[model samples]
Target chain A: MQAIMTLKQVNYQAENKHILHDINWAIPVGAQVTLTGPSGSGKSTLLRIMAAMISKTSGELVFDGQPIESYDPVLYRRQVSYCFQQPTLFGETVADNVTFPYRIRKQPVDHDHILAALEYVGLGEQTLTQPIVDLSGGERQRVALIRNILFLPRILLLDEVTAGLDEQNREIIHRWLRHLNVDRGVTTIMITHDAQEIAAASTLAKVVAGRLEVQA
Target chain B: MNLAVNNTSLFFAAMLVLVALGISLWQKLGLDKDIIVGVVRAIVQLFTVGYLLKYIFRVDNVWLTLAMMGFIIFNAAWNAKKRGAGIANAFPIALLAIFISTGVTLGVLILSGAIRLIPSQIIPISGMIASNSMVAIGLAFRSLNSQFHDQRQGVLERLALGSDLLDASIAIVREAIRTGMAPTIDSAKTVGLVSLPGMMSGLIFAGVDPVHAIKYQIMVTFMLLSATSLGSIIACYLAYRSFYNAQKQLK
Candidate 1:
């Protein structure tokens, strides 16, 4: 399989400390790779670097056939989306959060599609106009997830998005991820600590002491 | 009739401070030390400025006038920079904002013949314009800093969705500008009714016609509004970029 992203000797440093040393990894096209590591092992930092949310201290990162820097940051981010561990909902209502992707793209918001996505995530049509301030943690996370997929990206970076979800919601998210990866062919690179999720992943990668180790 | 303001009369004006000090002591306000220090500083500073202005006016040199204006603007910018302590390049940004606003307003005044290009005229007007711009820019910086910090998550989320820097920060920028311009706008609205401003009263005390003093005051008000608006907008546009990194990510 051709690789969608290749990071060669990427390193991240902050405040005179090497957070990620000379490290390298490649993400395959249409692959769901579970990334596991002990706490503070630079998992999220690596994910952010892949998402272009942060600049690498040194080394080369290429996306598709071109250098990441060659692409406009806005357009690059649109094609490669990132989800935060703590979901952030902006503006006033759930509809605001759900339709942001369309807003930024200057496309007409499809309320029907938004309602459908909310329903798929176990949130009803009534949740569309609900105030974001009134949402629970699970609801906010689901909204953020649905927002990320409103317009599909070639790759999705998940930074422990399901860390605090209940079993049912977690299962829903897992099923959603599988559908996205299998049916839609969106490449997924997720940081996770769930044992079952780790056991079930088709491809597993670990970041130990800032180094990548692929498991067969 | 011109009211006498010789040294004797001015010396007697010290009665006002004594009255204030007596009241503070009577009320047990414990403000005696502060009042004494403030009175002494005010006297010294005003006398020094008075003598400097007298000398600059006598010479009537364009360079001397310009140097005086620059001094006022530099001091104003320095004070404003303190309000934006953590913002990158805050001093230069403040200086530029104050300079442009003051320069533009003074240029218009001189060109319109409302004020002459001399120390007596240009220096005082420049002081007023620079000081107002400085306050406006300071308020703008404070607003920008707080808004960016408080709205970090919102800005980051917008960036994640591929919104460009300007698009991500438009709302915050507008809010900061509005915050900076609010005082000027409020004073314009309540100009004559709320209080008699300094320039008009000073002209009146100098035996200028009331109608003429009112005209000068109106001109001052218009110039102030223009100065503050320009300063706030320039400062905000320059400062918003400080919140982001080279990767276009929120710092």
Candidate 2:
């Protein structure tokens, strides 16, 4: 498979301290890649670099044969989505959060599509009107995930999004991710510490002391 | 009306400071030193400005008038910049906002024939405009810094979802503008009912008719409203961009 994203000699430094050192990686198209690392191992930094949420101090980052900087940032981000580890749902209610993707794109809100996605995540139609403060941790994560996929992206970057969820919620999220990867061919790069998730990933990478090593 | 303010009357007026100093001593408020210093500073500063204004009014040269206005505006911008410490290029942003707000307000007053272009008129009105705009810009900068820091997650979420900088930060920007303009708006709403403004009271004390003083006070009110609104809007729109980098990523 051809690589969808490539990074060469990526280095990030802050206050003269190196955070990510000499990272070189190629993410193949439609691949489900899991990144595992100890805390403060720079996994989130690498993901953010790929998402273009932060600039690389020195590196060549290419997405789809073009330099990452060449694309308009807003346009680039639409195709490469990033989700936070702590789910941040804004606005007044669930509908407000879910409808944001469409609102930004200037597309009319698709109620049926929203309903279907909500149901798939085990949320009911009434969840749309539910206040965001009423949501449980799992529900918030699910809503956040559903928000990202409402307007499908070429790549989905998850930063320990399933952290602190109960087993049932984790299983539901994992199943949904698998469906998206296998059935819909959405390339996924997830940061996880879950042993089961790491074991199940076909392609795994580990970051130790700011260096990346691929583990088959 | 007794308009005589000779050295004797001034000396008697200065004695009023003893009342405040005595209260501080009785209450053990630790404000006695501050009260003394404040009285001394006020007397020295006011006398210096009084003599300087007399000289400027006597000279009455356009360049001298402009130079004094520039000094006032510069001082206001410098103070406002201190409130915007962490924001990039905060000083220049504040300077521009204060300058434009002061210039536009004064220009309208002159062009509308509400006031003459003499140092006696231009200098005092310019001081009011610049100082008010300075305060508004400072408040706007403070609001922007705090909101951007506290709401970092919300901004990042929007950015990650592909919203542009303007869309992502519109809520914060509006809130900041409101924060800056709130004091000016509140004062406008309760102008005469709450207290007599300095300009109006001074004019009335100097034997101008109460009706005429009221008209000048109305003009001041209008001028301030215009100046503060322009200053707050300009400062917020410019400062919000500082939170983002050239690549549109939050710094």
Candidate 3:
């Protein structure tokens, strides 16, 4: 099996504070990897580095055997979708937010596919026309997830996506994620502090103070 | 009509002073003393220019008019810089835009015989063109800065997707251009119905025929629109380059 993403001895410092230091990690293709850590354990920083939101100070990152720098950052990001911890919806309508990536890419947007993705996330058809500001937290998370899926990225980076959701919504998300990984072979790297989610993951890695230690 | 000091002027001046004092006393409201000082300074400056203009009209020396126009441009540039303080090298760019826009507009107007090359025509027309350009440039800078800030993350996202920096910023640049031109557009739309413009009113007061004053007014309006559009477009394009580094990444 080939590794989908590799971080070799990565070191990152932001605002004079060491965020990720001497980090070596690998995610094999089609793996369901969950990163579990305490608050301020550099999980978000590592994810951001993978997404190319911030640059790493030292070492190399390679995605699918190509040096990350060799590929355009925007193209890389498009191929790897990062669902933020706090969902950031751009447009006023759900349909607008979902189709944003397609619009940016200048591709033909399919409203039918968008509606299907929304339905997959348990959102009603009418939700597409509803204003984003009127949506609840759970609805917004679903919208973000649908957006990521619609973009059809090779890798999905989840950052505490269900942190603020109720148990019902949490179960719905977990089930959808499990189905995505097990059935579709979609590569998923999720960060979570939830014990239930940690127990359910195929592989669990703990991060402490910028260092990763795979749990026994 | 009698040339006596009108009660309206005294009342307006008194009201302005009262507002300044009130704002000064209410420091907790975030109104700074510099704002009050600026208002007072403007009052003094405009009054001084008014008295000097009377002597200038009497003497009718072209050099004196040109010299005073230079002073007005310098002051306009300074005010523009103050308004757009955060932009790097904004003062020089703003001054350059103002100079180019005003010079082109005035030159075209004079050459076409729309405005006679005299103090009465040149002074007011040049001042109007220069000040309007200054406002347009200031708005362009402000809109550019705010648009960049608001869309920085989205722009970075686009860059990571193999899009060029120019491609990523195109939407924001378009928005800024639209916002920067809004005032000029509004003025053009409402020129006659909403307000009587200063140049036409001044001409009427100087005993010119109404038809003649209307022609000059129409010419001035079109000139202002052209000057503002050119200044804003040039300034926005120039300022946008400063936001990115050589590595094609946002700074």
Q: Highest TM-score among the candidates is held by which one? A: 2
- State the lDDT at B66 in candidate 3: 88
In angstroms, how far off is B24's CA in candidate 2?
Answer: 6.2
lDDT of 2 by residue, B38-151 (tens): 988998999999999999999999999999998998899899999998888888898899999999999999999999988999999999999999999999999999999999
For lDDT, the strongest prediction is: 2
The better-scoring model by TM-score among 2 and 3 is 2
Q: In candidate 1 chain A, what residue range of length 10 has the lowest lDDT sum?
A: A19-28
Q: Write the per-residue lDDT of candidate 3 for residues B1-251, one digit (tens) a residue.
A: 33445668776667767676677677666565676777779879888988999889889998999898888777777777776656777887777877888888899999998878889778888889989988888788888788788777766655544456667677777777677678988988998898888888877777788799888789978898888887787766666767776445677
DockQ result, candidate 2:
0.79
Interface DockQ of each model: 0.59, 0.79, 0.20
Kindly indicate the candidate among 1 and 2 with the higher lDDT.
2
What's the true lDDT of residue A148 in model 1? 84
lDDT of 1 by residue, A1-216 (tens): 798999899999999988887777777899899999998999998988888888899999999978899988889998899999997788899988888888788899998888878888889988988999999888899999897888888999999999988998788888888888999999998999999999998999999888889885
Candidate 3: misplaced stretches above 4 Å?
A179-185, B1-81, B85-126, B144-175, B186-195, B237-251
Q: Candidate 2 falls in which docking quality class?
A: medium
lDDT of 3: 0.80
Query: What RMSD does each model have against the real structure?
Result: 3.4, 2.4, 5.2
Candidate 3 residue pairs in backbone clash: A73-B160, A74-B160, A74-B161, A75-B160, A75-B161, A75-B162
What lDDT would each prediction earn against the true structure?
Answer: 0.90, 0.93, 0.80
Position A61, candidate 1: lDDT: 92
Question: Interface Cα RMSD per model, in Å?
Answer: 1.2, 0.7, 3.5
